[model samples]
Target: MTTIKLHNTKTRKREDFNPIDDKNVRMYVCGPTVYDRAHLGNARPVIVFDVLNRLLRHVYGEDHVTYVRNFTDVDDKINARAAESGRSIGDITAETTQWFLDDMAAVGALEPDHMPRATAYILQMVEMIEGLIAKGHAYAADEHVLFAVESYKEYGALSGRSIDDMIAGARVEVAPYKRNPMDFVLWKPSDDATPGWDSPWGRGRPGWHIECSAMADELLWKEPLRQDRLSEGAKSQPHVFDIHGGGLDLQFPHHEDEIAQSCCANGTDEMARYWLHNEMLQVEGKKMSKSLGNFFTVRDLLDQGVPGEVIRFVMLSTHYRKPMDWTEKKRDEAEKTLRKWLDLTRDLQPSDPTTFAPDQKLLDAVADDLNTHLALTYLNALTAQPQKLLDHARWLGFLGDKARQDDEKARSAYTTSMGSGASDALASLANRLDELRQTAMQSKDFSQVDAFKTALLAAGVEVRMSKTGVDLQPASNFDLAKLDALK
Candidate 1:
């Protein structure tokens, strides 16, 4: 078994991953709010965790891993969008949820084993809140139930902040209630117009932090659906799952509150064994925001004909722990590289099924706290083994069925524009041009090289000459007839 290591945000160190039940490895990542389209920054954690999920499936058997990402359908943002757009909350959430799934699928993310909606799990949230109140960890005041932060001794352990610092530095809701300033809401009353369900605290909805805690407990740990897989001890208290993950922006308040609620309610030392968080993203070296004029959604890029694989590749080139900068230069470079790799492996067949496995070097790179940039560097050196390269790239969520079909169509069109032997002829011409350039470099004379380059340009071929070699490809306005003179 490969010893997978991950950086735990709770401990702030990289450690070996030891699952509570290796036969049933579990993970939960915080998902989208589903109020609108997911912007470019939103795609970072999706891609980062997608890669980690793939690795988990590879290390453990595919069926052994259980991944759950929740959908926050019952958020204030959804309510506001509904009122502003003159649409029902249900209609808005449904449409926005589908949009999120489509955009995420475009980037080659596999759907998690469970996608629990917060609305569907309201009963569980209510039950958890009741338990918290019973245990004196929470109290009902002013038609709302708030978690008493003072009751939990290790309230700020996850975020490493003192309650005084949190109160001073973070936003604290100063309601005239009998509680500490850092106390958070577990359930708030909702009016008849708002989306609400029947709760002990009147008609209301669950707060954002408690939603994840309840849903994660139900789906990942204590669900009756997976009771058969549980041990006698696990069945008693299954609150501490293997991994919990989200973005760095969510490290404070959101995740901290979840930790406090889950631990205090379930009577556990920790909510999860390992916590992972991917850093935020930027656009062109600046923060991505609408005010910065660099903000765009994933769907926007897809509509502009940017291949999903290109987006995935550019994202993976940066380490997940570091801030990723999206730039046009990086996008173009990634596209060019994927094009070359796809063309190289076009004629190759899939590796034998019995012997099928990802390259050891690449797997090792990713296993080291998801060093995707290094894994990609290892992939670039696997061209000599085309089948291995193709298989490994696919394993990393590249070169899917669509990409292969698109590459085939592109190659076929280029072949038809020239002749049946056009590919071979172009290769021969590229070699010939390279020889001329090498001779010119040695003799300090470039008459032949310059003339060949000019002729190739006139024929609508993009001639790229470098120290590496010469590469020739048809441009949009390629004229096969003009190339006849050079042939």
Candidate 2:
């Protein structure tokens, strides 16, 4: 068995992963809050944990690993969006939830074993809140239930911050009813205009932090054992899952609060054995912001003809702990590489997944803290073994059935549309673009290159120019007359 090592945020060290039960391994990753489209930054943790999920399934038997990612359907953000858009809360949440699912699926991510909606688990959340109050870890005041942060001595252990530091660093909500400044809300009163559930305190909704804790506890800790899906050893240690993961930004208050709530409510020292957090993302070496003109969503990239495989490839190009910068140069390079790989293994049959075994070095690289960059390097070197290359690429969520079929369809379409004469014309146009680009690079003026590229794009041709040269392909709306005019 390949030993897996992960960087645990709780301990801040890379440790060997030993699941409580080898027969059944469980992982929970915080998922998106469906208020709007999932932006590029949101996709980071999705792909990062998606890779880890794939690795775990590969090492353990496919059926043995259980992955749960939650959907936060009820949140203030969703409410605000609903009010601003003049749409019902349910309508907005349903639409945005499907958008998130479609965008993630396009990025080659497998749906987890469970994707629980926060609204669906409101009863569990209320029950957990009641347990906390009974245990003297929470108090209700002003029709709002707040977790007593001082009650949990190790409240800031996961983030490695003291109570004083948390007060200073976090945007602590100072309420007249809160016992301490750092105390967070478990439940808050909601008016008739807002979405609310009937709870012990009043008609209100669960706070963001409590939603995750309750859902994770219900799905990972209790429900699995209740269903007899886990071995006896796994059930012995309740309230502790194998791994919990999210982005670094969530480390401060959200995750810290989850730890305090789950541990205090369930009488456990830890909510999860290993806490994993991926670093943030950037665009063109700068933070992605609408003000910066670089902010976009996963759907944005997909709409611009950048394939989801390319996005996943570029994301995994860097180690998860490092900040990943999305640049056009990197995007072009990734597209080129994936196209080449797809061409090489176009008609090759992959090994049966049940009996499939990846190259040892490739598996080891991934197992070593999910060094996807090194694993990609190893994948790039497997071109000689076409079968290995195809199987391994599929394992890494690339060149799968859809990708191969799409590549074949595109190639066939291009061939049928372009006779020998038009093929020569397309090649000639590519050579012309290459010459103009080289000249512009030397002269430091790109007016001619830009104009020609714009014209090609207007004619529905895909223009990809890189350091090597220019490669042009005709789209479904290709215009031979446009090419002749350029010639």
Candidate 3:
């Protein structure tokens, strides 16, 4: 059995992962705040962490791994969306969240073991707030209760930001009721028009960060265990779980506050043994935003006929902790790579009795903190040898009988529509692109190479350049005459 090591955000170092029971490994990933359609930026964490979850299930038994990803159903953003759409908050959240789930499923992200909603856990949130008040970690203001930042001495440990710095950086409005600038709201009184629940403090709603802490404790740690009659004298358990993961953007006040709240309420030093944060995704090396006109929703990409698998592959190509720049060229390259793998395994016998012999070095790379980039290097090595590539693609969840069938149908339709001479023209263009790309590489003129590749793609040829060399294919249903006219 391979030992899995992960970079623990809490300790700021890489550490060997050892589950509490060695039989039941529990992980929690912060999920989407579903107020709008999920963007391509949002897809990174879903696919990257999903792969990690798959790797865990592979290492441990499937039933032994429990993964929880929560949905933030009750948030200010949801309320604002509800108002904008002229729908109830519940309706908006439910509809958008369903869309999010569908998009994630399309990208091959497995449904979590539990998808706890903030609205469903109101009672738990209330209980936690009451506990915090009783413990003197929180206090009530006029119709609201705020967590006392001063009470938690280790408040800055997780984010490495001093309380003063946090106060300065905080975008939160300073309500007159808050005791300190750095203090955050646990419960804020709700108006008649807004969503609310009757709590000890007042009729209010849970704060955004509080929902995750409460839900995680309730669903993961505090749930009762009812054993079957076969196991006499079986005891309920409260053993520590393993990991918590989210985007790097959450490393600040969000995760820091969660750690403070959960540890203080539970009276434990560690809320999560390991904390993992995947880096953000950028569009053309700029932050993705609608105002910037670079933002792209996952649905938008889907509507453009980009396969969900190709999207997933592009997300996983970069290291999880490294920022990835999304570009059409990258997507085209990933599509070509997938097409090659698909073509290699298209005619292979289903029961060919191929051994599941993945390169041990590749496995080691993945296990050493889920280095997907290195794993892809190994994948490219396999692709260099077509026979070996078909066998190895199984490890990537790509080149099985099912994958072959699916790709063959898609590929045949794609190729037949391109006419007789189109394939040969595409092949010639690919060869030219490779030669030009190589010259660019030798001259270290990557910009020109990128432009040349884009030109080929514009002319209805897809090209992938990697360490192993260049691989190319005709675009799906490409119209060579139309392409030539456009060029």
Candidate 4:
């Protein structure tokens, strides 16, 4: 059994992962609020978790792992969008959800096993809220049900904040009805204009935190939640899940609140045994914000002609623990590298798909806390063996069967453009650069070497030189006519 080490935010250490049930390994990652197209920052966790999901499927059989990423359809933002667009709430959510799917799929992410919507589990949310109230962990005031943060003594354990500090620094809703400033809403009354469901309190809907707790409980928990608050043997029930994850931003109030309500309602000590969070993302060394004019949706980049594979490559080049910066330079380098690899492994397929396994070192890198940057290093090493590199890259979701079909078409076009004369011209240019280097080494005043290199770049031909020789390669937009002018 290969040991998997993950940094658990709950324990604050990279501990060995021991599944509660190996036969049914489960994970739940916080998903998007479907009010708009997912931005680049939003795509980070999707890609990060998708890699984890793939790694899990490889380690544990594909049938053994169950990954659930939920959709937040019932949000104030969704409702506001509905009101502003003058469209029905259902229409807005439905359209936005499909847009999110299309954009995430474009980024080489495999869909999770479950994508639950908040609206579909209203009954479960109400049941869990009522159970929390029955356990005295929550109370209703001013037609809004609020969870009593004081009731959960380990309230700040995950976020590592003292209650006094939380009360002072937290930007909580200062409603007169709340018992404590940190007390968060479990359910809030909805007006006739807003989306609502009939509840014991009034026409209302579940709060943001409660929706996830309820959904995860119903879908991923090993056992149904213990509804009866006074059952003696209830605490021993198997309500715990394997892993819970999301962006680091959700660590404080959102995830903290989920833990409180879930433990209280289910009569368990823990909701999830392990917690993980990927760091945020940025654009060009600055925070990705709309005001900065850098915040762009995933679709926007795709529309701008950046291949989805390039985006994924640039993203995975950095570990998920560090903040990722999206830059055109990174995209260009990623595209050039992918093109080179595809050219090396073009039209190659596994002789036997059943026996084709990912390279062990590549899998080991992924298993060790999802060190994707290290996995890429291993991938670079395999470039010498095209067949092995092709097999491994496929497991990492690059140059798969479909991508190879496209690669063949592009290779044919590239071959047609670079005939015998063109190849002869490229070799001649390489020899010229090599001769220039040798002359420069002796004269120490060969301005001609720099001049020729500048001219080659102007003609859009990438040039490389070493002690032995020089190499020249063409970019996607390489101009042969410009190269002929240089010649």
The local distance difference test score of each candidate is 0.88, 0.90, 0.78, 0.84
Give the CA lDDT, 0 to 100, for residue 452 in model 2.
96
Q: For model 1, how does the per-residue alpha-carbon lDDT over 1-487 read when each residue is reduced to its tens digit?
A: 7889999989999999988877788899999999999998888888999999999988888878999998999989999998899999999889989999999888889999999899999999999999999999999999999999999999888889999999989878899875898999999999887999999889999889999999988888777767778667566656888999999999899999999999988999999999999998999999999998999999999998788889999999999999999999998778777876786788887665335688678888999999999999988998778877888888898888788887678767878766766667678889999999989989999999999998987786777766789899875346777877887
Q: Worst 10-residue stretch by lDDT in candidate 1?
A: 350-359
Please identify which of the two predictions, 1 or 2, would achieve the higher TM-score against the true structure. 1
- Compared with the true structure, the alpha-carbon lDDT of candidate 4 equals 0.84
Query: How do all the candidates rank in terms of lDDT, highest first?
Result: 2, 1, 4, 3
Position 254, candidate 2: lDDT: 90
The sequence of per-residue lDDT tens digits that candidate 2 reaches over residues 1-487 is 9999999999999999999887778899999999999999898899999999999998888988889999999889998998899999999989999999999988889999999999999999999999999999999999999999999999889988999997887788878999999999999999999999998898998899999999988888778454487777866787888999999999979999999999999998889999999999999999999999999999999999888899999999999999999999999878877876886798788888888888789889999998999999998998778778899998988987888888888878778867777678778989999999989999999999999998987776778777789988765457777876798
* lDDT-superior candidate, 2 or 3: 2
Residue clash pairs of candidate 1: none
lDDT of 4 by residue, 1-487 (tens): 5668889999999988887766677899999999998988888889889999988887778877889999999999998988898999999889989999988887788999999999999999999989989989999999999999999888889989988999899888899999999999989999988999999999998899998899888777633432332133323446778899999989988899899999989888889999999998888999989899998998999898777777888899998888998898999888877877787787576546455678678878998998999998888888779988887877787776655666677656867977776677778998988888898889997799999988887776777665568988765666778777667
Candidate 2, RMSD to the unseen true structure? 5.4
Candidate 1 residue spans exceeding 4 A from truth: 232-237, 352-355, 411-435, 441-471, 475-487
State which candidate has the highest TM-score. 1
Estimated TM-score per prediction?
0.90, 0.88, 0.84, 0.89
Q: How far is each candidate from the true structure, as Cα RMSD in Å?
A: 3.5, 5.4, 5.8, 4.1
Runs in model 4 deviating more than 4 A are: 222-237, 350-354, 405-458, 462-473
Provide the lDDT at 160 for model 3: 83
Q: Give the winner by lDDT.
A: 2
Candidate 4 local Cα displacement, residue 259, angstroms: 0.8
